[model samples]
Target: MKTLDLLRLKRRQLTTLGAAVSLAAALLPGTLHAADAASAPEPADPHQWLEEVLGEKPLAWVKERNEASFKVLKARPEFEPLRQDLLGVLNARDRIPGVSRMGGFLYNLWQDEQHKRGLWRRTTLAEYRKAEPAWETVLDLDALGAAEGESWVFHGAQCLGPSYRRCMVNLSRGGSDAQVSREFDTVSKQFIKGGFELPEAKSQLTWLDENTLFVGTDFGPGSLTDSGYPRVIKQWKRGTPLSAAMTVFEGEAKDVAASVVVDRTPGHHRVFFQRALDFYSSSSFFLQGGKLVKLEIPDDVESGFWGPWMLLKPRNDWQVGGSTYKSGTLLITDLKAYQRGERKFKVLFQPTATRSLASYNLTRSHVLLSVIDQVASKLEEWDFSKPQAPRHREVKAPFPGALHLASLYDSELPRDELADRYVLYYTDFLTPDTLFLSRAGSDERQVLKSRQAQFDATGMRAEQRFATSKDGTRVPYFVIWPKGATADGSNPTLLYGYGGFEVSLQPGYSGGRGRAWLGRGGVYVLANIRGGGEFGPAWHQAAIKANKQRSYEDFIAVAEDLIAAKITSPRHLGIMGGSNGGLLMGATFTQRPELFNAVVCQVPLLDMRRFHKLLAGASWMAEYGNPDDAKDWDVIRQYSPYHNVSKDKTYPKVFFTTSTRDDRVHPGHARKMVARMTELGHEVYYYENTEGGHGGAADNEQRATLQALEYSYLWQQLGR
Candidate 1:
């Protein structure tokens, strides 16, 4: 039989048996709370309960569940079909609509077509009335060839244009190192002189004026291997030579860039540079009309990590914008008055627990705060006229899921015409996205433009389920299942998660994962595990330090529940995670290899022993313990997959993948793990892309091809 036909035959057999296995497991269970600690107090801290149930290691439950789920999923004869469909869905190109207001016109960038190797092109639309309207290209990564063809990639362009006639594109390149460069040009499309470049370092550029610019550069202080990007902000002028870069503000110690806002008053121009080392430095000088005064926001020494440190914990929120004349006010969030140690902040509007102060823009008097709260996603306007006392009111609108704000343009139109009128754009997990020209506080809203209406979320269900970790903590995950799947279980499921850093994986529609995976017969689950900013800061802190094993346990519980609930048996179950999630997959695989039939590990950091010495790993030491320290190493070594691979044990079919250009998590981690696993007589598939950064592939075609190969491999293993 053909490979696909064989897979289909195996899938059908597994589906029929999977239902029986799930029912048997559920009926054979001793008690629902058997996983809980017997002697633990009724109101014991969830962490303590987990320790009691899972012992000091706390990964036992994951192993147990993996075995149980694997059995049930494997029983299903239709398992391979569903698994293939899931993989196929993730391989297709699904378009999303993106809009930005540029040159006084609403421009849309939508998925144009599947280019070479299944990559999607983001084509721009200028929305002109004439038949032969001009088209401007925003980003063209298509020039970056497939992963098999290249060894480097350029991405993340922060473009700024002081006037319509001139623009500056600040882009970062990733290969051996993350480097930043500035491309200067006139609005008339003429190249300018004295561009800036840095090698083997990460940098960001902010334009102070048409002629002056601020560049932040990070240099490795100690041995380059052990050093981090200690930052210094420099000033560069148009006519100055490359060697003439002048230092404007230097931090007392290891200060990194937190935030930078530029304000121009009547007589002088001021720049606010907030450093991560707990200091805010401002540069103010006399301009043509008004006196420029630079102010530094002092850091609070008390509370340490929770103190008023710009880098550690930002205590204030300031919005900077201009009016019709490019004049705006700065609104700061005052946390000094609140009792110090409280984890929460009171703002003008209800703050989304998952969102930070990152999604706000400030004018002189009003603050536009984007809130992604549960039911409604909105922007709240706060009037900070009184420095000590600020007032806030909600700005009503039709747009929801406005988690990201592009740029707030200054309108010269009258208040009667523009006060209620504002340009709003946003996208959600199910919504393709839309741009609107409507009044912020007005009831009337009009859709100015949309891109890729072909995107749809019909008959899809997004369910939020809570899984109790071995430690008893309630972990929330969003599961997206097909419309007709039986909740009684017996469906092929792919569980996904990324639980590191305080970054919350907000529910946004993903064409790559959705169209390629879930659109078929597969179920997709996004585990919002700990070490993320889902609930609050405390939620993340609970999963940090020596208690980090709770994150792995939390992921395991979800997989176990899926099996006990009969979603699919273990034979058809698969798990995939990248980056920190890559770490997650490794931990899960080692702790409970039998729980999954196939595992896809991408650009993973399996070698925890040397993680800190690689790329940006040193900077994240605060999050993960210092493995060099004896006590820390003891705990880290317990779950470090690379160190724990045993010659006596058999692991599931595994694919260790990475990109040669992945400077973030060095490809060495994947290479070392693959080498070690292969040496141990384990079957492991290794495919390293030559291009793309910490993210696997550079272009759409490369991404599509990689996904296809990945899905094909996954289905061949688990689907059968």
Candidate 2:
């Protein structure tokens, strides 16, 4: 469900499957022009008023629709029970508390029924190993919000490592991208008066030292880029006005953002500047002798520092030092040598046709590579201590689930102690998450925590199946069959996908989904189609812009494959996706309405033509394409869901969900689509959450309500 529209480009999520269905003749060039002609007010978007977001009329419309839809959805027999069960899962005190190492303690944020917001707490690693860790609260979000009279959602805190006494805590209202960063003293558990703080904005700040910060925020009108992100990165000194901050780096208004990332890695204190040219590419620079020294590398190639070692992962084929390195190859070189125009490198991981490096992390002495074989995950550890000839070893991990790796190394700790230890989290549809602590050089590991299963999984089983697309590309999908379910095409199956942005959909557990859907005998499917990283860069690049329709076609192929195999018929099949996948849901149903009976389109981008005009929409032009350009529009207009909804066709009773606080994708996309479809005599259900940003839920209660509403709607539409 990650929008991955570069909320500062920590892009780790992807999209689901979809279909390339039929396009009505009304969408033809002449007809499109006519419908968009001068006679119509705003032409094709007569329901443009809905895009006004918080306008009086739009809010009233949202309220009325929410009330109307909830009245019926609540009346369903399965709704309340589902809601209660999900709420239990959401508020369960026994749930594993994820922690991060900060100085002498592991910090965690815990929320329950009483603590609707959360508690920023800490405990010793020894205490964390216990069944019930004794937590000492550093800050109580519910208390802070109550005392401040702000509906603050904690966006996390960036504490200065080594000492970890000072922290920049980010808080967002409801759950928008705009974050207010306040400096806090961890020792006193209080915000520093008159310390460095930024008002609500999509801002980034890192502690260069206790007295200075590398800041990127909206300073004024010209400070923000066209995408509403910070165009300038400044170094702000303590006890100075934000306007007086010295500009360290600046990017053009057309660029996504300019940011300064300060790495206080003990002795290797370096300041890196990144100017994101687009959503997926950036030109990186480092401060050398008070001048910005640009990294002479491909803009799309990811470059980072691991101690004195330079890490590079080229997204495109890079030829250097008289040899060509293929895309998705993870290479390492000495930083000092690389800076001196020497391209001498050692290959840590090379991609085969079917295997691509998913992710990698560095310890004091090891390089842990998470690779993808077909769609499964594998871990490889390279002991980079001996730079010339590193030791590579295969790390055995649990499968049919995801194996997540994270370095336990705290930069503040002595390089020798914590750097070699890492955490691994494994989970799937049925398996509850198990957190393991392992040492890089040793195979032995200790289980730190394991989540209790919230659903009955006695007879449920998951299997991976491949579907041949129209272009003969084999798309993989995982299906979790419910107990006693037959393959006679009668199962109420819910197929989920998000096939965009190179974000691979790996195996993960969701108690809400498991209890409310699969536990109720619903078959769940996950599609690994084009526009995902399942097969790496080539797979993702194959579905961007003009060729984006391939993602839909690949998704359609999976649905067809399911029907052919008699797993589920069209009547009993439903589809669900969010963000870009929401657009997939829209395009799929419009193209082939008979293929699915239910759709849960959440926080989606529906109008492709005017999407650039929306909040953060301008940033995605590189991924989607510049609709302002007529050539790109020629192809985009075909798959644009809002434009393709046919008045003459019979579509499913689609359910649309969005949030008023979703500052990323505009709520107008959902509003206008619902308005257009409903006006065209189509049965549609719409719900606009007044809070909750792009995720469509603010707190656990709201999240539970959404699940209840969605599953209830699915059962009504697709279940017997």
Candidate 3:
């Protein structure tokens, strides 16, 4: 599940901690207020002590809870087999070796039983296309970790443009967001001696060239945001003391963060300074002749440049050049003209009540658009051969599943050049992922690879169904079940959701979920509720702050829809979510305890009252209203799982999962909530992995084990 957070990891990685940096020269009105100081005096939260993440008492409490939960979950009859089966799927060598385009090579990070920490290897484009390519290992993470005596997780590397040999390799100690970045020479396959390096912190570094970097980190006092992210961007040169680096930009302490991003598209090597004012909004600036020039655009808009076009995807309505563009509109203008005060925009895509743009990528002469109509995938390729206007053509997908497109490996051409080749990945609840290579000017698409099905899906079928929500709005959901399964209200069904941050919940291949749940005749449901990009910004904005309960209500509507259709009863129904979705689960089970039999809330933010005071929580105030605001708290406290828990209410046995090393959402949210619930005499199980970050697993083994534990708990509770 996608969380509203960003981290220092490669963009290709499936997970992120939160949004990128936000900076400001001065504090906005009320931005510097203490998050912990409520508008009114508040009663002490008895379990508050658990918020001390690494404190002795909390560790002891965590250990005790882990042992207790282990006795219950591990004792399940299916736990061992489920774990072993998942392990086999995870360790399978036949899985797709996802490639990254860097320099002149196609790079991949592979992990298996033999190399749990993974191996950073690369190959030529031709060799990568051929089966069983000859790969050159550049970094062996397992060996490096062993040699350094640290559980080093490879965050990723930012290589210099063009030649792309020198890079800043980010390494996390035990899967935390704080990581140490070291300069490495890809050609030599070794760390560069006397090269640039940044010690561990939630940091960001972009290469201005090989010898200089735009750095943002915890640089001494007052250099970090309240969210524990870098608040200053500095220009650091090689062979100089970090303290001597010139501060180029500074952000407000209350702002999320500020960092520099260099568009490494060769000739289009533009440097940008971004200030994430909050989780979903930011102001961006482009460096021109050593001066920071603010881009004339809304802070809520997402802007980028491809070729000669300046692109804008606005989350709010914008009025420019006598045209009022609606929210969720994608507009384009000539970059030179835009800089010269030409506000006229070419409308590329617009969202309807039922359709919204999920993602878009620029090719050499076209823009590949991935739009979701009612949560179903729709592909469109717009040819911008003529800069004045572009001709659009819809590319029909070969199969019925969620389709995602990416450029071919090593296609890092500049904006002026074409990135005509792309790889399309399509999959759903039952279908294994299949990859296809498509060229901009070609009609024929080549099948590049297909993942082997981890579980037999011979009789399984996926159906899209809608349910009426509390506000009488229709909510869509996908249910994957056996073809012959009847709506007898007896099937053990698992419902998942992540209804925040405009993140669309699209269908994808999940071998672990398929094998652990569906292979056992269990049903899986993905709810496309409000507060998501399923229908775009309007859909998400409909459930923010005071309206946040709408998302929970929408989720309940889907749950009730399943029960009303006789698909599953509350006694047989379960729910799972992480990060913001974790908040969804907590709110749901608390507000409507009778609706679900089990819940797997992982790396969640439960204690809304103090969430802002926690690591990275304050940054998300845009998505979730600040608790310090009494007006906002009035609504927040109404559904906050921690504040809403009651001793008199009977709650289902919930399994709380988190990572001690998670530097994003503090593990304290889970620990304190569980502690409070247990104190209130509720049935709850807890497990805190010592390593995994916000995603809750550092590697596949931990991932499989965690999945096993979750599935085991669900089955044991639902009587599957």
Candidate 4:
């Protein structure tokens, strides 16, 4: 046998032996809560009672857990300091006020310690260029919430454009996904007494014209998908009841979601409809002559129009015009020509082994592409007005970090003064955020604002490292080391990872993270493992569903690599992740309990078998296979953390956090896991915030508190 193959075989045998020993211990006698990994799975979930989201019993349980966690975390000496420091970052007024260009004004939603709920306001371009531009408040969320006795969170507004005089403003109670939408007059600065309004539910709204709207919302029963998102779209005219609105399109209940976006770019006004078949797959359609015509593109490809050019980004390879465009390639074609049955496409951005299209933003005549080269970011602009097709130009920006570009151009309003201008937000691990304004396709950029450094990085450094996984795939991760840190394995290390949903974890400045962790002599590591889009769709695709174990293995490889490098031993290592990454934390800690001393699992999907049944969980079946399917369950059960929790095995003292208002991932995931672990005699810390939806916080104070609690947990566990 080949040497590499021989080595792999021996490694697998050793791993199997270790797993067998763990499995034997898992089957030991214990109070049954969640199903044991080695035992025949329980037909009914014992802790399923916790899934009662707002039930009296569930809230009481959540309260007790929160109190217990607070008593421990709040007692830490570092907790208050961390909270105050992080809160200052959150409430800083000098932080760049990100704006959206509309109606000859730059609009922003400003939030601080004073205006914790947020203040929607606007400023002229000339004023915005000044150090402290004067702002005219469009809506005061704190005032509105107080007036209405509601926890109103600004969900954004969809304004009718060309002349953005009127808008449909959306507000949610406590930052939930479901929102209450109402029409308002921008000039009058008041909610229209008899204008369009929608009751709370996940909804999408786009103005078709001054008198009409295309809305996808919960009409009633059967109007929502199994994932709890809009499944039916309708056209509602002005001065008409919502019930009287005519149905335009209806997607299946099994579908993930349905949404619509109407572009009113002068003569190029168009309506785009999207049906999310699954999390990573969707079909696009455009309304033509009052009929919905499906856009001829792959289901997994994102289709959109920028000026006269139609952009198509495929998540998988596309074979067209006698050529195969690789996955993650950005292709553009004339919108009218493509609609008239032409297949020719010009490649705007192509992915290489080291380069992938991270994202793109559209101006009137250009599309700025954020290209990721080996996890570093660069910008490129493609001008569509070129005769030979859109001419590509490199947009000069700071490198070796994340470059976030947003166009000030109002595509819906073609006659715009800011049509050619865009905003660039740049940041790195040790650098504070700097916002710049530049004309599209040109290097004439001007610094608009820059934030003060949040933490001392005098002797701190950030570097990338790669570790080989069990399958021989090399995984990349970044480490931010503090001053005087050495290879003695004595420093406390906090490693974070999120390896799912094609979401690429890039280097970005987080003031709260920096102040709470790095500023206090803690080393921070970010793992860019499989199941993330750091390399492209292939990177994410290689670690999903039946291959999901690959992500867990990659994370383990990174942890093992850190230990081998003597950066930190298991005693001082703490790992954290949220949402999909929360599942990563659960599986990793359960699979290799001795790898670390602390695990922070936030809003996790623990019970894979019942994940699909949870709110919004059905949409993620594309990433994680349907556990109800016996064949899929066979592979999933191997990594299902809730099912794999062992009674006799030693485990890290895991800190689990979730929100009672989290309508996306059920709080029960955290609740059941904690309950099961506690029942199995494993002491664990649990915290369930009362508000903040899936984010676990409603406002800045809540955000700071949660962050402080987490840092305190890390210090208590890893500081030793």
Candidate 5:
């Protein structure tokens, strides 16, 4: 018999058996007595229900189920196909080449021909003897003998001398709390003596001059207990002893980095110090002669929420660079004045609603800005040469499905010589990322390079639709369908979303989800629910704290819309989300159990009552109110999934997965929920990986295995 037929048969048999058992109990004199048959008070301890149904050791039963499921999934040929797709996507960019200029030489970083590892090499402009030519390697990463996993070595190199002849190489081991060893070099080939070693340092190094360098040191008496916020920034001079490092400028700012840009006039340098707090609220100051002078306004600025600073440059009188905070709002700030206790800033260009600023750069005379309008998924370029009256010229959106701002590179040529020429790189959900050069005064853009040309994106379709929530609120969702799919809407649908924390779930390339899920006769949907930044900050604030349940209701509305629209039936519907999104999955599953056939909950914060007590949970109290407060508890208790699991109600088959190394959201949340569900006579499959922090699986291989298991569970529950 087919899988669906078998499932139907099993369900019918189970129903008949349950009815027979009930009939037999009714006929028994003592068993049917009012006292014996009184509806048992709801399980006082919900967790006890798991022991009652799945035997005394609930976790052991979960382990056995997971192992059996893993075996069944691993043996399937379909599982191997997804694994192969994952490998292909990860290795697709293996030999790609990229070009840049540094240290008076044209530099190239590409995958080595022999070992297929990334290598950095440089060649002088005089050696090449061409105005514009292909770059060659001068200093390969393999020759440096840097240990494996230290791929960020390129970012550690900085030029020291005025002639751009000498370079300082700082090598870092491990991420975050890295041990940095600095080696001075006059030439790119070798390192000089008398190097300094920084132990247990989590800060990045910035060169002040040949002898003077800025090293950041964290100060808190000892280590900080809060993981969400950044460590305090304290500056130390290069020659200072490790024990005697002095505090130059210390505030609420966490990690700080400095950059020096030569003024258009010779012999003048504009040094900028960019500091961030809690990975947000980044501000930059222009330092002249080792003294803080002016503050450079980031090209994209709205509020202090702007972060992930890409670059800083003194553009004429204004400083320009890309700045993103929150998610949607991108602004170009023109620094008017910067002095102690007095600062003036102005927005050069701001994209309106439903549009997000992607890239902004200033040439000598004109400013170039890229904006992605979410309404149409279109890319537009605005010319702000005439700041008083900027003109927007719509450029073709880079990709059809979804367009993303990848990177921007300022031309090496003189400002006047290059005129209006600039490079723009963009990618999309289905399209391979590509780079193109656009010259001022010309509409024609030339392709510089493409990251993925072999991968075909011919038939992918992305469409936006709105679903009405229980409160009559409209939630937007993006749906991806396979090429050549019939409109009959019989395809299996996988709806994924995370609707909290002002995070906009923008559509972008997802090789794994695209090839493994959508490519295999399935539909993928991303719901832009209320808690996300799709609309604006207000959208997120609306669904936070007491209104958190709105996000869950919004997710259910999308799923129900998919079913009602015939996109997929309940039997073929699967929902998957992680972290905050994982909360959405738990609430949705418990509140509307029959709406989905399968759910993939990863590192979920399900135990709402005690979430604040867990790692990184205290910081989120702003988003999810503190349950300790009686008023907050009243609202939290209404939708806390762990507290609402009903013993009498049947729930959909759920696969709860978490990692032991997930210090952000405690693994106990998943464990306790699974235990509680099982005790309530609900079937649940649980998998707890031992590593990978809050993300769960560590290595790519482990990630692939876990993803395969998740998809397999969905197939077993929904595809049946």
Candidate 6:
């Protein structure tokens, strides 16, 4: 599932196997708590108690573990310095105030030392273009939270289309997925009396009109999926109570989720019901004349509307009206005509072996697409209003760093009056983020803002290189290292990766990494492995389910290449990843224990066999096959890190981190993994923050402390 706001948080090279030392003497006996080994096929998880998220016993366990880990890392001299440096970067007032165009005004949320909770404000477009825009405060979260005695964190808002005078403001307590939404009048700068409001739950709502709302929230029993997301959607009228709202759609309890999207584009004001059957599969239906008419398309194909046309992006090859559209092809068709049984389509973009559609945004009369060619970004604009077939033109923003484009289209404006404008964001390993405003079809671009450099990147250099995986696939990766660095394999290097969920890891500036690691003369590597969307859906599908091993193999290839190139050795090399990448780190730690000296696994899913049984893990069954199935288990068991951790293996000094407030991926995965390793005679460090959701940290200070501890651990373990 996509987060609602920002801050959301390879060639085979064989390495010698490290000799296994006697761990039985070093480990504490009977540390496994209590579980009958003969009760089940594999022993029942002895540390299952940790799964009870707010339980007193589990919290005590978390506190003890956190204190122990904190004491060791805090004792390091670099800890305090790292914390201060990161906190400074995070709280810098010079950072760019990113804006969103709404109601003919640019809205922005500012947070710093003065306003830690942030201030949501807006300014006129002309004023925003100036060096010092005069911002009018719409809401001060710090003040509101203090007045209400709540830890209210802004989750964002859904403003009514056209006028945008009314909005539903989403606020989360301590940065959790669950949020409390309240309707407010932007023009009046106050909560709307008797307006639509929803209590704390993993909920979402969108504006259907000034007084109508299409919402998906917890509506009592049997209204939520096993993933803890809403399974039912209701259409609530202005004067009616939410409890009496009309039920528009309902999904099964086993379904991943059910959400509604209301398109407000001129001539395409339609409401659509989206039922997510699994992580990557969904069925879409648009409301027409009081009926939910299901879209006649493959379940795996992603369907959406752009202006007056329906955009279809298929994950698998689809044959419609005897025409076979290749996978990864972006097909567009007239929305009204298609609904009336027309099977014709216009190809906006097609996939190649090296080129794929990264993403697409819409201008008033044009379609702007950001394409990835060999893991680099390129832009193109299509004018579909032409009498003949749509003509495509290149909209170039040439740069070494990754460039992402977002179109500035307001449905309230007419096509002729709309400006051909889009927002451009660019960044790399060393370069700070630069925001630009440019015309979509033309090259008339102006620098809107540039982030101040958070670290001294004078000697750092970024280079894109390829590593051949075991299957002979050329996987690309980016490495940032100091100039004049030697190839003697003495420099400390940290390789990071995430190979699942179609999420691409692009080259972006990281102040924490720059100050803590790069400034200390270290190499940083980002692997664009299979299962990531660096090359689009095809790249991701290549390493999913039964073929998930491809991702693990691809990661190992990059690690071996780093060592082979003599950039860093096993003694100095380290690895880190969170969420899905945490699974990657776990597999690497257990499967190739001799490859590195340090591993940082954060908020990860280590117990693959039981992953689906956890909180939101059931939603990802499509990404990783159901482990309960015997055939799938046979393949999954081969790489299940929790099951693979052996008492006899020589493992690296690993650091595991998690959060008690992570209602998405259960923190039990990390807790249980660490417990098993320790019980098996390996000492590991762990820290479970009490607050923060899946992103792992609530505010800037919490983020700073977490980064300091991690970098300190890496320096202590990898740096010589």
Q: Can you give the TM-score per candidate against the true fold?
A: 0.70, 0.96, 0.94, 0.94, 0.70, 0.93
Better-scoring candidate (TM-score), 4 or 5? 4
TM-score of 2: 0.96
Backbone steric clashes in candidate 5, count: 12
lDDT of 2 by residue, 1-720 (tens): 001234533333222221111223235333544234324333244677777777998899999999999999999999999999999999987788888888788888888888888899999878988988899999999999999998888888888878899999999899887899999999999999999889999997788888999888989889988888888888889999998899888999998877777777777888888888887788888898999898998888888787788888888899999999988899989898888999898888889988989888778889999988868788889997776778999988876567788787876566446778888888887899898989997878899999888898999998999999989999999999989898999999999988887878877788888898899999999999888888888888999998999999999999999999999999999999998888888888888788999999988888887888788888878778987665676678887887788788899999999999988888988988888788788989999998888777768888889989999999998887
Q: How many clashes (backbone atoms < 3 Å, residues ≥3 apart in a chain or on different chains) does model 4 have?
A: 0
lDDT of every model, 2 decimals: 0.52, 0.83, 0.81, 0.83, 0.56, 0.80
lDDT of 5 by residue, 681-706 (tens): 88887887755545565445556778
Model 3 ranges off by over 4 Å = 1-40, 264-267, 409-418
- Model 3 lDDT tens row, 1-720: 011234312211322112110111111223333443354345456677777778999999999999998898888988889899999998987787888777577788999998998999998767866767899999999999999999999888988856778999999988888999999999899999899989999887788877899899999899999888889999999899899999999879988888777765545667778888887777888899989899888888888777567889888898878889999889888888888998878788988988799888777778888889878798887887775667988887855668888865232454322257888888877788887878875557877778888888888989899999988999999999964678999999999988887777877778888788887878889999898878988998999998999999999999999999999999999999888888989999988889899999988888887788888878778888877676776677677777777787889999999999988888988988887788778889999998988878888889888888889999987764
Pitting candidate 2 against candidate 6, the one with the higher lDDT is 2
Q: How far off is residue 143 in model 5, in Å?
A: 10
Name the regions of candidate 4 deviating beyond 4 angstroms. Answer: 1-42
Weakest lDDT window of 10 consecutive positions for candidate 5: 14-23
Measured with C-alpha atoms, the lDDT of residue 606 in candidate 6 is: 82
Candidate 4 lDDT score relative to the true structure: 0.83
Candidate 6 displacement at residue 474 in angstroms: 2.0
RMSD values, in order shown: 13.5, 3.2, 5.0, 7.2, 12.0, 5.4
Give the Cα RMSD of candidate 2. Answer: 3.2
For residue 46, what is the lDDT in candidate 2?
Answer: 68
Please write out the lDDT profile of model 6 over residues 517-542, one tens digit for every residue: 89888899999999888887889999
* CA error at residue 421 for candidate 4, angstroms: 0.9
Clashes of each: 56, 12, 16, 0, 12, 4
Cα misplacement distance, residue 271 of candidate 1 (Å)? 2.1
